[model samples]
Target: MRKLASICLVFLIYFACSVMSAEDRTIYQFTVKDSDGADVSLEKYRGKVVLIVNVASACGLTDSNYKQLKELLDTYHERGLEIAAFPCNQFGGQEPGCDADIKNFIADKYKFDPDLYSKINVNGADAAPLYQFLKKEQGGTLIDAIKWNFTKFLVNREGRVVERFAPTTAPKDIVKYIEKLL
Candidate 1:
């Protein structure tokens, strides 16, 4: 029937363009908002090895992850390493604070000085475009959706995503990959 044909066509179009193709796409192509709501382009990190992670303030892994991440930064930040931590509240509502509060918590608890980004959804229909691209490029064990907070995506100096780490994988565990990229 004509109505059935129209529905199928609409479905096909939507499926094809849900997200941009992961191939030939670099993280530098996107612009994201920092904690202060200022637009920051990933392009500035073009020649640096970058670790992008979704963080939650109240998660069980918060302490270890932030400590290890800060360590990694202190060790390799001068050697061309950059960490982009995105505060996400999708997992169990862990990061239930405003940008200022999140910034204050990290600074006071862990002495983390890097720029904190605005809270973002790492999964579901409202996922950020950068996240959508990262998930498509390096899919998970059973699904492309992000499993939980602290999911890390490592990008090479060329701005392409090279590795995807789970929420459970500590930042210290991937120093070799970062060193290699650097």
Candidate 2:
């Protein structure tokens, strides 16, 4: 009947659109809140090599990782390298603090200022959609679940998640990859 035909056409269109969207999805499509609670579109980092890291203030890896991250930012920030740090408390309650407290902690301990985002859950049912997309793009050896804090996702200029580094991977160890993308 005419009604059946119309419904079938609608379904077809919906299916086609979903397929297209999946193909076109990228990091640029996400907008996340910063430490100050302002929404920041990832699109702003387009055309830049971005290192997206889930950070923690009290984690054991904090010192060395933040130190090396500062060095990397200082060295390559002008060369189109951006480090986007997202604070996550999903691991061992390491990042337990308000945004202001976390910011102050980073400043006092690391003496470094990073593009800090709001605290978010990186795993489980409440994981941020941005983290979900990154995990889907490059799940690494442990699959979609993020193993620990400081897990980093390297996004190329095109906003594709090209690499996933473990929590223990030093920021300095990623310079070669960044250089290649730059």
Worst 10 residues of 2 by lDDT: 16-25
Which tens-of-lDDT digit does each residue in 20-134 have in candidate 1?
5755589888999999899999888989999999998999999999999999999999999999999999989999999989999999999997657899998889999999989
The segments of candidate 1 whose C-alpha lies over 4 angstroms from its true place after superposition are: 1-23
* lDDT (Cα) of model 2: 0.92
lDDT of 2 by residue, 100-131 (tens): 99999998988888899999998889999999
lDDT of 1: 0.91
Pull out the clashing pairs in model 2: none
